[model samples]
Target chain A: MTSILSGLESVKQALASQQFALSITQRNVANASNESYTREDAVFADVTASGGAAVSIQAYRDRFLDFSIGQEMQSLGKQQAQSSALSQIDSIFNENSGQGLQEAFSGFFNSFSSLSATPEDLTLRQQVLSKATALTSELHRLCAGMQRVQYSVNSSVPSTVDEINSITSKIAALNKQIPGETGSGNEFALRDERQKLLENLSSLIDTSYYETESGSITVTTGQGGLLVAGKDSYSLESSPLSGSGFQGVQLGGADITSTLRSGKLSGLIGARDQITGYLTSLDDLAATIAARVNQQHAAGSDLDGISGTDLFSYTTVSTGSNSGAARSISIAISDPRKVAAAGPSGGPGNNENANLLFAVKDEKLFTTSTETASQFYAHLIYRVGSDEQSAAEEITTQKSILAQLKNQRDGVSGVDMNEEAVNLIKYQKAYQAGARFATVLDTLSSDILNLIGA
Target chain B: MRVAQSETYRSFLGNLETLNERMNKLNSQVSSGKKLAQLKDSPASSAQLIGMRDQAAEIDQYQTNIDSGSYFLGMADSIFNEVNNLVTSIYAKGSQSASESVTADDRATIGTEIRSLRDQILALANSQVLGRYIFAGSRTSSAPFIVSGDTVSYQGDETANKISVDRGLEVQEGVPGSAAFNSIFSAVDSLLSNVSSNNMDGIQTALGQFASALSGLGIARGEIGANLGLLNNAKTNLGSQETSLKAQQSQVEDANMAEAVTGLSQVQTALQTAMTAGGSILQQRNLFDILG
Candidate 1:
């Protein structure tokens, strides 16, 4: 029952299949440079048990590699964010360039020592005032710098949330389109775009996602809060807290700021807390300076032979509150004569009180009486610097890991132009053989019809 | 690993970027000469540097104190030396007046000279240095002595002004007017009165007092000399401390220029190699190019 016409039909199907395979090879070569494009192969199969041929496009990709990349992207995002914020703090507290808090503190205390040398000298008294003024101004500048950094970090939350929402929206749209084009070669493009969007979302906030049985992906935050489910995307809200005026991230009316463990959002939140901690330490320094110096100064006599008042003053929220002390601290007395340089029992030449003030530099007064003001401030700087350094190290580690994962993914899914070229030659040769067979079948069928007519 | 065409170029570019970053870092280190441009570069060392700077500042302040103390003590030592000379002259005048062969006119002339010398001693006792009376104890704003007619009243206190020259070590900057010159003033008053009234017994007593006053001046000068010695020792010690502290700070902060420069050139060579390889590596003939 094998006829020339059916034989010709089988050759025709073979030729079409070869052409399809060649086109796929051409497509692979064309998209070799595209970062997101996964390589495709035309899979040929017999339509019948032994006769006709058919082809379908198969995309080369690994779901496990994509998942690993997403996780690494999250870690890299967190480290990069922390490193950047800490660098800003480090610059603000940089002492190597001089004119830092350490210098200001030394200047202030050293001025008191000089004042003690010439207790009655008006010029020396002025120097003490000037140094004190400079110290207060330095404290103010540092506090403001930290506050600005905190504010900037806090304000960025809304924009980051917006970015996450935008990415999730794109993912949901891709999720809708992926299942519709599942059997067709177009599904590869939809899946590639969705995977890219998922990686972008993971960097903004720690997230986990999985492809459903229907080929649609479901995305959730690290804490299992739904983001993109099937074809629907959820949005994150940013609202300010009551007392601090800092932005808090919320998902569907639930605060998720504290639950965020890794990603840019968490890193920014952690940075804000670190900055606040530094600010608190600075306030403690300012408050302790005001209280301790005022006590010693009040026990002494000024150049006018009157009991000294508080040398430094700051606004207080309550009786024992140290908050905002750095911002509010100021020299209480303006007159140079008001600087307490003499002891209570002695005349203008007495510098006992001035000596005591200078001695405050070494006192274990701040941080639960374990460190001097200078030591505490140095510790704060060390903490910031070390935190930044650790974050940078983490980023380096994460980046290398991410790079390796990306290369592994490339090995699985990336296009090879050389392989494509070889496929092109094989498919072209097959197509030519099928064409020659079709021409031979046509001649044989003509000869068979001529013999039957005779 | 099955490298894709894009992956090869991408990895090459990444390697080039890393090499370039290293070169830039080394360049900055060489140009700036500081290994720790930021605290984050080395936090522990940066903290140590801050502490060292603070200690240096403290040492500088202590040195200033030592200098001020030395100046005051040096002035006091010279004042006492002159006082000792005046006391010696007064004692000779008293001894001559006490001699029985001396004429009343001769005694009167000697008494006038002794009186002039006592007035000079009083002036020395009230000497002001840098607009503050040195011998006025804590009341240094005004003169310590008030002379009314033949007698001198001490207006200053008995307290000696102590200046801090070292930690827990305070040195008396100047001898109090009462301690250094009060007995001298009384001795000179006795000598003047005894010579003018021709009292030989009183003249002998005044000579004895003058000897004691000279010894008192010697004690005060001895204390001043001891303080000056302490100040000098502190200055030397602080100088060495400062030098050592600066050395430690440099160790923590300054970059090794030789190492940085060598590293820079090494990175440059790597970058050039990478670039050259990239040119050939990326242009690798695939089947498509060979076929064409």
Candidate 2:
């Protein structure tokens, strides 16, 4: 009698295990479209010497693949951010629309040449002033655009740091909950949530994380700086880079801007430097142009019979300092009658001065080196275009890599509806078979009992 | 390997975005007829394109200069022809009046004709074009020749004002009044005085003076003719140069319409194919479809 009861207990435990398996399959089929949900499996084990069963459900996830995704996602984030910023710079000039610095500059110089052709043509003198205004305004527009790009990068740093801190704290909270749930019950859903969080964190900044025995995760920077240890998360702060409004990232009161290798934060930093570098070049070009043009202009005589003075006024005349000369430059000589065209006050129709200014277009006056103004401007455009093009291509390549990594991860963790359906039917059939076996055992025992009684 | 539905969707979406961007780029090329809509499309080419454009613009300015130079030369050319004609008339009348057969009254009558020719030559010396005295050299605002009683004086400077026709090449706007007709006027004045006095020997000597003056005028005319020729050749050369520069600029900037249209359709076909192929995978139904 004791043996029969033990056998019935074993059969009942097996039926419960099959029911659990069916429920797991049902969960998988229901969550097939959920990107955050990983497929679960019902693991069965014999608990008694008489073959009694017990069940544990677990999620199938590859830790190495998660680490690869974390690393790959960081790069994709960086390239994406860099590309977005560079393209913003590209659009500001509008090259094809003829709304660019190049056209303005050439127009201004060409106007000078036109004046040289008919030095006494009052209409052409006013045209010179118009072209000068256009060129100066375009320069200011470009300078302002560069400032805006820098300001944008500087402004984004704080928000990005705040986002990082928030994400890190959430990861810490997830870290606290995952171990507790894993120790006492099924942690499949919690693990899925934690994985999603890690991927999110990776996009903001490069990170490394590992799972402990209790299923808790320890997070750190890619370079091994502790970010989150168990349930404690470190926070990042922003500090002024200089007396200027520009801010740099700080972790534990030490700037980690240079240490940041991959992610949007690093991309923003790189882009800011790129914009500043371009700003310096523009200032240099402006300074050299102003210096040379003013010199030639001052050597000639104007319609007012005064010897030429500086044609362009600016905050600074220094070329190498790059101290915002482009933004500051404007026409120093306002009176159209004050425009110098005579060589040494020779006569009104001489036109030697305007010719000198027109010659500035092809002269090596834009740099201390031998590059002409047009050449320098062309070089600047080429540099900017190259930077943008490279960034975009890098983003594409990084994105493809990230996608490949994601696909690899999804292969192991993703649920197939057809597969889940088969598992559901399989478990259901096994449940039915177990019930039939129990019924047969009951019938045999009852028949034997009747015989004994007779 | 198992295809994750989310990943497939994301990949298809990315591919579609890429195709769409390409389509938009080709559309821009077709619409604007420019291949380089942005600098980053091709950096080196963009820089080269701008450089060539600058060169073309500079060439245009030079062309304008050439046109103005040609007009100035034309003015100088007509003035020199007038001076040459005056020199020829002075020589013919002086030689006929110097012969012994001429009567006193006839010589007096020839004196008046000669004086009229002298006045005409003086006026020609002070010729102005477009309100500017072309013979005044750089002093273009005022006439260079002055008449006091019977004698003419040249007040103009000796400098022949030059205008640039090309880079480093210059042509004089007009010859100085002193250089072209100064000697001719004095010779004509002397012949008028000789005819008035009825002195045949003085008249013969004045005829020789008229011959030399005409020769001097002929030399100045030749120089003016040569300068005019230079201006013509410069204009023709500039036109041909402008033609070549424009062609190069077009090559750098303009898109080949035929190739662009063909490529546009090809890209469209490729996009359609990609969509169809991606469609087949994403359209695979769940188990419920088969069960139903």
Candidate models: Cα lDDT each: 0.86, 0.78
lDDT of 2 by residue, B156-231 (tens): 6664545555656666555776866778778776787788887788888877886677777778777877877887
Interface RMSD of 2: 2.3
Per-residue CA lDDT of model 2 for A1-454, tens digit only, reads: 3466676777888888898888888888778788878878788786452664488887878888888888888887787778788888888866645558878888888887777655655677788888888888988999899889888987898899899999889888888887767523357787787788888888888888887776678888877888898889999899888644478888887778878988888888888888988888888888888888889889988765579888888886454475779989999877786677666754545567777777777787655667898899889889888998998888788777877877777788888766776777778888898899799879888988999999
B15-86 in candidate 1: lDDT tens per residue? Answer: 987898889889889989988877878889888877888888888888888888888878878888888888
DockQ-based class of model 2? acceptable
lDDT of 2 at B274: 86
TM, every model: 0.97, 0.90
| Superposition error at A168 for model 1 (Å) | 0.9
Q: Candidates' DockQ values? A: 0.69, 0.46
* Per-residue lDDT of candidate 1, residues A1-454 (tens digit): 2777887778878888898888788778778888778888999886442465499899988989999989988988888888888888888886877669999999999998888777888999999999999999999999899889888888888999999999999999988888888778678878878888888888889999888899999999999999999999999999997677789999999999889988899889888988888898899999998899999999999988899999999986677889989999999999998988888867777788988888888899976789988898889888888999999889878887877887888888888777787899999989999899889988998898999999
CAPRI docking class of candidate 1? medium
> Candidate 1, A119: how far from true, in Å?
1.3
